[model samples]
Target: MCGIVAATAQRDVAPLLIAGLKALEYRGYDSAGLAVLQEGEIRRVREKGKVREMESQYLADPFPGGTGIAHTRWATHGVPNKVNAHPHIAGHVALVHNGIIENYASLRSELESRGHAFTSETDTEVMAALIGERLASGKSLLDAVSSVVHELEGAYAIAVISDKEPGRVIGARRGAPLLVGVGIGENFLGSDAQALIQVTNRMIYLEEHDVVEITRDRVRIFGQHGEAVERTIHESELSTDAVERGEYRHYMQKEIFEQPRAVADTLEARIGPHGVLPNIFGVNGDELLGKTKGLHIIACGTSYHAGLVAKYWIEDYARLPVNVEVASEYRYREAVVPDGTLFVAISQSGETADTLAAMRESRRRGYLGTLAICNVPESSVVREADLKLMTRAGPEIGVASTKAFTTQLAALGLLALQLARHRGLDDARYADLTAQLQSLPKKIEKALELEPQIVDLAEHLIHRQHALFLGRGAQYPVAMEGALKLKEISYIHAEAYAAGELKHGPLALVDEDMPVIAVAPNGPLLDKLKSNLQEVRARGGELLVFADGAASMDGNAARGSILRIDGGGDFIAPAVFTVPMQLLAYHVAVLRGTDVDQPRNLAKSVTVE
Candidate 1:
């Protein structure tokens, strides 16, 4: 995902644009650039690395202006380099963009035929060229952008500045997210609220295919059909302190430690003295649950793993058959839609392109209704969902998810209990499950106490090139998520398999260099999992086991090491066991000198397919 921040102010806004890019650094980017209408001309500066490098260049020689647009580019159409950075200019137009242009190749060819020379191999430059072509035809900046966007066939959020217009920034969004920050004596445009939090908090989230025009004194919006429109301005809930990495080495580590509070927040008010509240999901959630015969869970990345865990919970507790599918594949293939099945989509930042598209496509496939379990309330998935369960994991800034994943489990746990009520779950059993959830925050705190042990355990993984994770039953998804964390942040090749599947094919790859990690909570599968560990031990694979305190691995001390997590039992152990996995990844990535928060080539919010 790329980040965009633009401003039309009464004063010079170079510093403001740079600060906005710095705030959006967590989104992940490979290059940074800015363009300002200064000194009666459009001046542009771009660098191939971090925003700090571009900031340093701006400090040495500033491009002070009353109107400007800035971007942190995550390479998509081309490689990450100065020549491929954003703020690509042609004629009088300077533009920065996020999202892919599906018809860029054809448009580039047509633009070239019109005597337009392209400088960079980017779809965004094609946008600038097309808009610049319109500007040459005596069209206004707003008209030029609006006309050019009609020809582009894919998702994009673009901000444009024309030297012809002194104090104006025109922006538009199709499938990607874009917002306008309302400020006195200034108006701003950004990819999200975080990019403009330093200047203004009140924002207008643009609808799909909406175009906006901003100046220091006025704001105008056009609907998809070129008709004038109005949008509500809401105050952003994000605070500056929420994004700061205070008392932690990286955002990933801070998010890992914030799971207790995040889980508590997601569970708050949903659980009561008796059991989970019926209205926790929405006003009509209880009715929806009553009619739901099955569930189709759809998501991507960590959220997809979350759906895999929910499949086990709903089937066991609610007695409902469930099907979980990756959103990217779900949308492309022919799927049988079971009648009375509720479609559920999970995403941390609900802007994930594949998941959002799948949710939209579900409308035509005859699902009962759509439910969104997400963190951001303003996101597209939440806005479009028929019902919503918000995971109150405030502002997850890490590229690799931690608190968001746990909060998702907390939300899904509530969903399971609610559905169980409709299936004749007894009061006593409901009370037991509620009590387990109520005490989960305290249990998560106890799990955090194992960080020092996990830090010590991480020393064994720092030099290793590969790792294997094992779990049975619901913990299999936890194992999958743990392996994803290690590979994402540490650059270690990792794989996860059901403990029972070890003898199938994966056991052949086990050796002294391949470390095997297992999630062993005291459950029916504990003994079976131990047998699988014995198989690994026989092959000389080092064991790094995260076991419950009661599930003892008495004789395996010399194989590798064991970190016992405290107070983990049925239903909640998956969430509790996830803590050590997160901590282990954090410490190993730190020890290996990797970018733990913003890993290479990975964007936090995937806005492009």
Candidate 2:
């Protein structure tokens, strides 16, 4: 949830550190600060806003030194205030940290007993304080840091600088990302590749519980015990457009509209003119279920919703039994993954902490080789998986993901069809499905024509306090995600249910003031969903219908208005479905004066658990 960039070099390093922080601005931050060790002491500057705010402060009184650590924090332990910002300092050690320390309270209590007065609410402050306390006992800097390692709890990628060791920056990672940039007589350490992408793409991904000691001329990697380990540097090829948001009000809106193009782009690159699908991986699909057999899908948030959409495609087309599990919870259960088990991991970043951890757990038990469907090519998930597909989504900057999620559905839907063909499905039906897949973009464009009215509908519901989205069968997951989007950015109270389940419980929440949004596509379930809408109408509930062309409305229906979308084919529904829901959330948030790009209490990348 925070950004960290540090450089320990033989030459001046302040300019490079600032550039790296600018590159990581898209990850999100609330405050910015930097610390440098120079002239036998540590100098620091921190501010409560953007990096620019810190920059202005630094210009007045810069922390000039060869070795330094910086942070762009998204406040968790304290409010976004100057005193709460990072680059917390001790007597001789200055440190910056990412991720939370679960046991900081107990640590703080112990430090307080030792006469270490706390100044900030941040768990990071405890790190510096602990190191200071240990150093007061006359321990070496390395020993002081190493001693605190055994006492700290929770995930962190941390960097420390000491006046006594002015030429080096000692760093370590337990869960969050940390990289070492190799340069002649200079070394770089950062939380993300983007932070160091401009300076040098050549770097090594630090492993779990690894301590990295960086100096002006050398970078040493060590195990938690200080045992030496050799690491290789891999080059990064990041495109300029990967970070720029061209000609859009916000990244969320741009990503929402990028869906059709992103889907089309993934198809052009992965699928051949001959209709053969990408690799299905050789792992036994049944093995993932503990020999009971079937595919086990793991993902988090938006990607998990995409997995749910793919659930329909796999079951309907391939006749394969499939189960979708949230990656964060997948490992906790004794899921008996059968032999030949196919584990499908869906992620946009492909670096989602929980999902990546789950994928590693699956590999540990000898499940079938995993398949990764992700947008980023060199991402951790893609690198670890046996087979992978890149969604070619360029870059999705919105905290509430739009393009990446849709493109994932498109790619996974194609994966499902590919598996069906491999399993000896009928050629004619496959051909029809292929045609539908190819025709999805045009239908998505037709759906975009309804956007202006969607903006209007969102404006209508903007002031309403609560909402419900309902769908049946394949569209059930679509309903779930639509509700998620509304609640994510707008801070609205929203929930989703199968249209058929209204009578069970969700119906009780419907009233004149509460609006119900229905995902009624032109299919067998359309009439069933329509009947549910009428049921809501009976209770005086306001209904906003997002429907296919076939969902007819009588002249002047009193309870709701029907917004028609071109539902050309069966497979096209889910691909084109999320467009309206995205715009609805976008417009509603716009009307409510909310920041659509970065919502409250959220970060674009969930790098820390």
- Among these predictions, the greatest TM-score belongs to 1
lDDT per residue as tens, model 2, 220-338: 88887878998767886665566667898888888877777888987885555456444433344323222323588899998999999898888888877889999989977778877
Estimate TM-scores for all models.
0.99, 0.89
Could you give the C-alpha RMSD of every candidate to the true structure, in order shown?
0.9, 3.3
Q: Which ten residues in a row have the lowest lDDT in candidate 2?
A: 284-293
lDDT of 2: 0.82
| lDDT measured at residue 320 in model 1 versus the true structure, 0 to 100 | 97
What lDDT score goes with residue 172 in model 2? 87
Per-candidate Cα lDDT values, in order, are 0.93, 0.82
Candidate 1 off by > 4 Å:
none
Off by over 4 Å in 2: 9-19, 78-80, 105-115, 130-152, 182-186, 223-225, 278-292, 363-366, 550-558
Cα lDDT for residue 132, model 1? 91
